[model samples]
Target: MPPAKLKVGLVQQAVSDNDKATNWNKSAEQVAKLAAEGCECILLQELHSTLYFCQQEDTDAFDLAEPIPGPATEFFGELAEKHNIVLVTSLFEKRGSGLYHNTAVVFDRSREIAGKYRKMHIPDDPGFYEKFYFTPGDTGFTPIQTSIGKLGVLVCWDQWYPEAARLMAMAGADLLFYPTAIGWDVNDTDEERARQHGAWETIQRAHAVANSLPVIVANRTGFEPSPNPADPGIQFWGQSFITGAQGEILAKADADGETTLSVELDMSRTENVKRIWPYFRDRRIDAYDDLTKRWRD
Candidate 1:
């Protein structure tokens, strides 16, 4: 059985430059600090190695993609083994010529890859023009087995989908994690920003409530200017957080600060909550075939 109690850590930071070495070295310092504090598992923000470049699609941006087990995995893998902790990291993957993906790689106390998940939901909005870059994940919603527990790791856009979370939970994921890089459009009204932030936080909390599992979220902070001179760049809202099985906020970082947050989770609580909720037991699986359709109409 996985441990009844586990300690987890999240690293939330801002990216000012396109230097992978500088960004990763900063993240490494936090990982080392958290491991010394006795955290068993640590998650870094999505694409922590570079600035969010999807603000505008440029074919030249493809230069940023690298193969799996390349530099990122090798660097983070050493960190995980040195700290003897389960480390979760997100990267831009170059699968082959003209093939790329938003990928999350995992290392479990070793300088080797444990597992990886590609982002399934590709958002193609004004600022988040992801569909132009990532191919929808071929890796299904399978939880990666780690020493701490079964980690259902998903990228930023994937956090908004209930179907993704439910499938991971159904497949026996003990905890859900979102390595996120989302923020407000700087030109939006105050109210609009509030709504966007609220919706983002609420939906993930709902996933925890429905699935009876904890959720860990790490979002980047600071403003990354857009390549388009006329565009107001993304202000990556840092508020990285964790929630309990009952959807209670455990720990949360400030919205615009670089932070390393840690929290201890009780696995037994999820077991107890599921017993009373019993949502899965009563699910109408046989009658939900229509969910596969894009739209009921």
Candidate 2:
């Protein structure tokens, strides 16, 4: 069994451009900082390699994609092996010609890819046109086994769904990780922005509570101007956080700040909490057959 206690860290930052090297270096600096601080596992925000190009649908954005064993996996993999830490990273993956995915790659204390989880949910809202760029992940909700524990890595939009979290928990994930890039429309009122951010944090915390697992999330910060001149750009809210099995906030970075969150999580708590809560033990698996349908109507 993995150790009962493990130190975890997260990096939140602003992506100013699509220059992959600069962004990776920026993330690398933070990873080194966290590792020096004794973090055994670290997470980087979603698509930290480039600007959130999903803001618009353009053929040119496809140029941003790269293959799995390509540049990104190698760079971050080295850091993982050097620091002797399990690193979870997100990137835009080019699987083949005209085929791409918003994917999360995990490296477990080695300069080799441990596992990968593709973003299963593709959101298609204004200023967040993801469906145009990504193919829905065929990799089911699976945990990436590592030196520390089992990490259930999910991407940005997948955070909104309870089903995704539950599936990962059922698959024996010890920690749930969200390498996210969610933010508010800057034009929305302060109240609206507050509500959106609140909902975002609340849902993830609830997942931790329901599943008796720790939750770690990393989100980008700062405002990125819209590619189209007429639009008000998105404010990538940077409130990355780590929460315990009971939904207690352990460490969190404030909104609009470029920071790292680090804390030691007690893996044993999952066993104790689940023994008391026993949500899985009491579930009625036969009654929810309609969950796969588009809607009950």
Clashing pairs in 1: none
Which residue pairs does candidate 2 place in steric collision? none
Across 11-90, the per-residue lDDT of candidate 2 in tens digits comes to 99999999999999999999999999999999999999999998888999999999998899999999999999999999
**CA lDDT of each prediction against the hidden true structure:** 0.94, 0.93
Candidate 1's residue-wise lDDT over 248-285, tens digit each? Answer: 99999999879899998998999999999999999999
Each prediction's Cα RMSD? Answer: 0.7, 0.8
Rate residue 218 of model 1 by lDDT.
Answer: 92
TM-score, per-candidate, Cα-based: 0.99, 0.99
